[model samples]
Target: MENLTLEMSKNTNTLQEQQLKLIEGNFTKSEALKIINNVVNVKINFHKLQRLSKIEGNVNDKCTYDNSRISELIDDQADMKSFLRSLEVNGKNIKISSTINITVEE
Candidate 1:
């Protein structure tokens, strides 16, 4: 169970790194939100699996610590998702206004 948690954390971290890359690029708002949603779902699934492992009495203190880490990850994911969604909406508005200005200038 500890191993599983560690693997999950690693995967989550990788996904976060990918999200950072996406932010660095010119990704659409919907694309960014999709990535964030994937991260949140992964974290939630990991948490559920960890809880089940604990209930089955197959997890140790290490697993408990990892579960705490997973909880933190989930919280971070939720915050990031909200922020990304806000950015997406704001960006779309800006783009629309810019396009309108260009059309007016033409």
Candidate 2:
């Protein structure tokens, strides 16, 4: 019911665990992407990589331990502000930059 997917590849063993470790080791997104590509030759974006690492790296685990908690994620006001600031002020949002081109392929 959760629509989960199981992507099988040759070197897919314990990949998320290694990715979580790389994230814990404070490697940047580009660094992680390059390492993954160099090791296994996968061309995944940083956003997808972040999804596998967000919980351990950036998220607080206090909400899950609470029984009567309203939210499962760390979505407090300060967290939201910090998230927005990272997206806007950090200047790493490549999607909004002017180098993107939209051309139809026929």
Candidate 3:
């Protein structure tokens, strides 16, 4: 079992090394397979495609993790409103100090 796992890791690395050689752009499955085949001398099948999809997922996770703005926007509020005061103070109707954070940007 250990040997099998190790061999799979090795295969994954080899596939990844070839995957890195792809041109920067989208391509059909056949085109992608061709590119990898040109650089890799191993078997290719749906397994590689599935593994590459996992690699793409990891890359996407990294992209989202690196984006601080997206996390901050999650707790986003459309508008903030303070409690209204209509009573009098010091013999005259007065509106106390108030603040509203309508929008946040960092």
Candidate 4:
């Protein structure tokens, strides 16, 4: 019994981690916009799907949080476009760095 307990404790103590440098580069304004828009669009679509699923299941039609996030992303996209447009040269390069970390919860 004691040996089994020790083995279980050791297994529980193990930690798993994953990291990905998804984006790291300098790109022109148009390129940056495309990259950013692609990522943001996926996130927006995911939330929209979640909202639709909930509504279909009769879980909740409002999905207030998801709706709010969709609005925020749309607004952010507008802001980003404005910022990019303000850049003096279309050839100017912008640096973007994104890291994704995945871990198991204890």
In the range 8-46, model 1's lDDT, one tens digit per residue, is: 122343333321111223345666666556756876887
Pairs in clash, predicted candidate 1: none
- Tens digit of per-residue lDDT, candidate 4, span 2-65: 1111111122334575556677777777787887788789988998988777668665455455
What is candidate 3's local distance difference test score? 0.31
Ranking by lDDT: 4, 1, 2, 3
Clashes of 1: 0
Model 1 lDDT, full chain set: 0.50
Error of 3 at 97 (Å): 56
TM value for model 3 = 0.18
For lDDT, candidate 3 versus 4, the one ahead is 4
- The residue pairs in collision within model 2 are none
lDDT of each: 0.50, 0.33, 0.31, 0.71
Off by over 4 Å in 3: 1-22, 42-106
Clashes of each: 0, 0, 0, 0
**Candidate 4 TM-score, C-alpha based:** 0.72
Q: Which ten-residue region of model 1 has the weakest summed lDDT? A: 94-103
- List, residue by residue over 62-102, the lDDT tens digit for candidate 2: 42332222231223434534544454324242221112123
lDDT of 3 by residue, 47-94 (tens): 355455655846545422233333333222111111112222334322
User: Residue 19: error of model 1 in Å?
Assistant: 16
Stretches off by above 4 angstroms in model 2 are 1-24, 42-106
Off by over 4 Å in 1: 1-26, 57-67, 88-106
Tell me, by lDDT, which candidate is best: 4
